[model samples]
Target: MALELDGFAVLHRIGANRAAFEGISSEVAKVARSLLVKLLKDKRTGVDGVRAVRAALGAEPFALVVDGLTDAEIKSIAKRLDKHNPVLIDGDAATVRKLVGALADGSTEPASRPRAASRGNAKAPKSKKEPTAPKTIARVSFKSAGATRGR
Candidate 1:
């Protein structure tokens, strides 16, 4: 599916119910905006943005963000950035929506904290697989290079 993170121009591309997409996008944006606010704090608001973002997207997503991004995706996005103008840089809503739904529905559970190492016990509890949101790429083009003349 063609995912449009900025402006949602191709929202219909996902084939999900329109209402559902709207709702999901709203929730995703809520979590993202809160995070941005926290990361770029305004003194007048005096809000702890990170905590607020965590509460909105839940602990798992927050932890994922805290854990940081992969070097590969970062490099890819950086390379793409050189070619395109960045209007908005936020989490991919479709991906984030799926994550939120998984979290809400309990289909995907967050990883458990590691147990303290013991000398007698060498084996550790199996860690639940960490959930991931799709990396927000830097280059998102609205139009193709070739275009028809005005009618």
Candidate 2:
């Protein structure tokens, strides 16, 4: 499945079986969720699979390498992740890893695009105004009577 996350293009491919853009498979979805639950303890490595998938969405990747798993394994994981969400990537593991590295190294711009106003209307003109200083609140103090009695 193809989706966007954290300003990155995400492709969640499932298992060895590739599916058309119809939707997610039930079995794949369950397995992917299970893997996520198991790896939740370690966010960095656990989420590496998904991150690798994110890399594939970039225009160009920096290197062709994955951190823990082999390139094929990571691609397989990407497939599994696709079950939960559509991850549409037309690249290999190396491409994905390179993109991931580029993002981390700040070599490439973030995946988020500058969104245009969806309203299809031009922005209103801004009126110039003088900057005003902040107002300070005055404090009031009252002394309590030493002795007080109910009448």
Model 1: lDDT equals 0.45
TM-score to native of every candidate shown? 0.21, 0.24
Error of 2 at 82 (Å): 13
lDDT of predicted model 2: 0.46
* lDDT string, candidate 2, 12-102, tens digits: 3333445563366775555544454344223344244445544543423212223444666555544443323222257766665555454
Local distance difference test scores for all models = 0.45, 0.46
Query: Cα RMSD (Å) per model?
Result: 30.8, 17.4
Candidate 1 Cα misplacement greater than 4 A, ranges: 1-47, 69-151
Q: Which stretches of candidate 2 lie over 4 Å from their true place?
A: 1-41, 44-68, 72-88, 113-151
Best by TM-score: 2
Alpha carbon lDDT at 62, candidate 1: 55
